[model samples]
Target: MRVELDEERRAQLPPTWQRAFDWAEESLGGRVVAWEAQPRWRPACFFELEREGEILPLYWRGARGEWHRNTRPLEREMHVIEVFERNGISVPTRFGLCEDPPGLILSRIPGRFSLDTATDEAHRRKVLDEYLAQLARIHSIPIEEFEAIGYRRPESPEQSCLGETRGFERSYRATKTRPDPMIEFQLGWCHRNVPKDRPELSFVVCDAGQFMFDDEGLTGLLDFELAYIGDYAADLAALRTRDLTEPIGQLGDAMRRYSELSGREIDFGVIDYHTIRFALINPLSVAGMVTDPLPQANYVQYLAWYVCYGRVGLELMAASTAVELDPPSLPEERPSRRSVAHVHLTELLDPAQAGDDGERAYQLDRMQRTAVYLDRADRYGEALESDDLDDVATLLGRRPSTWQEADAALEELVLSSSPERDPEFIRYFHRRLSREEALLYPVLREQQGIAVPPLE
Candidate 1:
């Protein structure tokens, strides 16, 4: 196959790439017959190089700083992958690297993408199970051997959890373009709930979409840049985040299969928590990415899917007996000046106090400020409630003597605040509601009410 390189893509290539390409051709004894830059979001280009009668896929990234092809860390990782492949582990066939600028040449794996090309539920499950099996094998490798192969683990559990929490916080903080108390609260929750005693760690493929498949149904992992010796749950979490459509039952089945095959009893509880954490991490990370210079439409779609899936994961985690994680206690819930300031305006607009005009006006102003705070916290329900209250206050400010108007206002609030619709919002609206009550009863009642015919 002749690789075609267009002028535009060639122009996009870094100035040092020509030298690197020449080096690769000479070093590998390949004829540079044809090459085209593959479309990708990353700062790398893919090319097809024909060498000694066989065509091969090649990739190269431009060096940003002092790091070059001969750099210790990058070369060390490449060598680790090479070693893994030599040991009969399935990996991409590495031809070699061009030392000048440090580009990699490897034989592309031939298989369809597991995500895009799996045709049926059975096939998808098989692929996912296979992926998990591979992960198990990787994780089962000795920690010392993994470290010898250049995998580095976090120094401490607190450091590892804190690092994960920090990444989530940084992403969310950056994307929303403002500080969020809810996000902070969630981060604190995750940190506090970090599991203890599940210390099994090994090298894991960390990049979001590292697993790739070709037309032939074989899967190969890619992007070992973020590979590290870490908690096994992190990898499972990444897989959950990547494969959002895969049911928790299927994941459990995969764990069973992996354990049976690898002779290691996997902790389903740890994976379950990490999977939910991964889902929660997605919205923040992708949101941050979209704010970058090259905002990708595909990434936006990925973020949307992840957010929806993450919400589902959140509900499932809440329902699951396995997910025992809980957030840290708030600094203060008492009715301090700050807590009072945080009250929603709608709550202040009680119909019982409609006769007290002076108090109503004062409360409305306070509610407006509270709305601002709730909005910052991503507490949309509370924010909207405040807005509704403000609307009622406006109505009352027009005519203070109208008792019917006040009653109508209260009814509107009640109808709008009903748990029948937007159960997720209702939970946030009324934090006292249990998860079971918030999710199940309202849905069941709504369905039941529809099924039973009303008296004419």
Candidate 2:
């Protein structure tokens, strides 16, 4: 790949498109004949480009806006990919980095980037095995390479657990514009519980189980923006987040296979530590969007799922630590406050009323999610206040008059807590937090998203 640029054409191109024609021609030495914008968040500027009488599927290293403000640029991933490539792992090839805006042009691999395509028993086992093995192989990569790619190594063995914690803090602090006491608490807990024993650092994908597969076999792993040098166990825990949608295989079996491939004993506690740490990131990121309120096309569904994701992570964290939970109390019923026009608009926006299958699903998700939120608000809006007041009063010495007052009081308590002690208080708050999230699950489940309930 050469560093040639057509300033005239580049200026005329769209940022989201990454100026496909000029980019392909300049980066690949090909005349672009066809291309289309693939559906994706941040667009990934993902494209199926045809040039020089062939198809070159591609991805941009950087996204245009704030959708994923924390994405590690493709420019950075280029070096990481080289490290993986040297290690004999499967990944997309970097054609070149664009000179002007510095985007990475990549050659896309074959296969649908999903788990739904695998139909038969053989297909499922083979694909799952390959996926797990690939992850294990990543952990086996020499730790020295991480440094060459700008990844930092922890000074001590035990501190290695804090690797991803740094990234989580960075994201949470940057995205959160207001008070986030639970996130603040979770971050504190992660810091206090750095898992024992220092395992060899591997190039772990902080967000794992995302890859592509064709009819023939598994292709390259996808999205290395979150790749880092840490305990491979971090990679194991990451799969829990994905388990809702693209689960690799049975967790117990996957663990057994991973232990075999890496040739190192696995630590369940370390995995638990990393899993809880990883889960906390969900609430941090989602709470930012939720509080600020994005004008998303499917805002209701987004809010429900966002809240659910946070809830699930907290529940998993509790389970990882062997904390028991009582069933969450049901919300008290009430009358609707929304006008008839509001209800009509919700019905009118149904996917069945308009849009393509994908768009329709998007619309229907929005509608369903909106209905859930509205219905919940109507049923327990007042009760939610009463419950929070009670919980706040229980946590604090007295009840606060306003929701904001209660929030501030709870936050003060969280921030001022002894990081090393108070097991009972921790369990109590964790359950209260889980119950709080339970309020959002019905809508989240109704949206037809994949979910992994607490593992019994």
| Best-fitting candidate, scored by lDDT | 2
| Candidate 2 C-alpha lDDT tens digits along 168-238 | 57766787776666666677787777776775777778888888887677888877876777777888778
Q: Write the per-residue lDDT of candidate 1 for residues 1-456, one digit (tens) a residue.
A: 123555564455456656767687677776554454433233345666776678776655433222234445456557767756754556777667656665555666556454545666666666666666666777666667667765556777655533354555664665565332223333444555667665556665654335555434445766565566666667755654554432223445655676687676667666666665555565455555434423222332333333354444445445443333332122211233344444555455443564433333434433343344343333233333343344345433543234345445434543344333233322232232122122222122112111111111
lDDT of each: 0.49, 0.65
Q: Candidate 1: deviation at residue 168, Å?
A: 6.4
- What's the lDDT for candidate 2? 0.65
TM-score of 2: 0.83
- Residue 235 lDDT (model 1): 72
In candidate 1, residue 1 scores what lDDT?
A: 18
